[model samples]
Target: MVSDGANNTMAFPRETVLKVASLARLQLTPEEVDLFATQLGATLDYVARLDELDVSNVEPMVHAIELTNVLRDDVLVPSLPRHDAVANAPKTDGKYFLVPAILES
Candidate 1:
């Protein structure tokens, strides 16, 4: 395990990477395993840097910035006539739109 002296976080091993890939149902080449091991290790090291910060006084917040809904007010509207709604469709049975079957038995 490769470790930076400043933090206790250890670099992810090839075995760990392979295990995670298996759990995630990924089929990775040998080169990809090594690449992912390095990348994942770097990501952990970067995140470990956060432990050095002084967040004791910082208050927890749901979002970094204030968020407000930008949606318009909801109001009841008249529905379009069935014929007009299906007029431009490639295939329709007057009451419902026809679509190709997407599932096989």
Candidate 2:
């Protein structure tokens, strides 16, 4: 496991990046491979700097604001009627509405 505090002293290898791409089923060209190698390498370097922090007294916050499930009463509220729903539709058959075919058999 990576701790919140780690030194930015280690190098992330290209082999690890290739292995991870394989796991993700990504087909990377040589150019993309080299590009991602640099980007992922820089990202790992930034992640390593977090290791120097002493978070012993700091609370681990999941979000900047309080997160609590607020339940609401299940009650029927005013809603749009069927006529209003189809009011602006381009075309409709008296008892039903028609739409463009989504698929061909």
Candidate 3:
């Protein structure tokens, strides 16, 4: 059973699980459907318990912890010469690697 957030609990029906599976394009067996119905019901009950918590004094933020950029400064670096870069390629035209055409007109 799942809570209604008003001290009321209700069963999470199998029909709801089937409908969710259909909407998600999932093909679930009868056993799986029953399992999901129970699991989802428990999850909803947990969320309802969380809803009872008092968070009025808590500040709303995008994340639980402050985030700062951790990326290193970009620096230009020397790269492998073009000929050496394509030397190990299966097919090359000396200037560029040749790949099979994936599309045709």
Candidate 4:
């Protein structure tokens, strides 16, 4: 465990940790800030350790298991009319659905 004192042993500086938290819009306590700094530093150290591995011959893959794309051929199909689609809706602006505003200036 990393100490929350001046004589701490974290890979990242306290100020850096606080800056990251601020950018993320997180409100962290002093203790939480120290803890997160220690944890994040340890994570970075682990990633650094991984950088030393020899993977030059390995092929890049998106998943650990083999996978194949399963998709249907694109085809035009009959669909519901716009009026019928919004018939049961509580609110609609004729061509589009009406939703509550989310942001305030």
What lDDT tens digits, residue by residue, belong to model 2 across residues 49-85? 8889988999888988877997889999989787877
| Residue 45 miss distance in model 1 (angstroms) | 1.4
What TM-score does each of the candidates earn? 0.43, 0.46, 0.42, 0.46
Model 1 scores a C-alpha lDDT of 0.81
Minimum summed lDDT over a 10-residue window in model 3 is located at 2-11
Q: Residue 47 CA error for candidate 3 (Å)?
A: 1.5
Q: For every candidate structure, what is the RMSD over all alpha carbons to the true structure, in angstroms?
A: 8.4, 9.8, 9.2, 6.9
**For residues 1-105, could you state the per-residue lDDT of candidate 3 as single tens digits?**
544344323346788988889999999999987777777776677776777889999987987777888787799888999999999999999989999897995
Candidate 4 residues lying further than 4 Å off, grouped into runs, are 1-8, 22-25, 73-104
RMSD of 1: 8.4
lDDT of each: 0.81, 0.71, 0.78, 0.78
Error of 1 at 46 (Å): 1.7
Clashing pairs in 4: none
Which residue ranges in model 3 land beyond 4 Å of their true spot?
1-10, 54-105
Q: In model 2, state the lDDT of residue 45.
A: 69
Q: Tell me how many clashing residue pairs each candidate has.
A: 0, 2, 0, 0
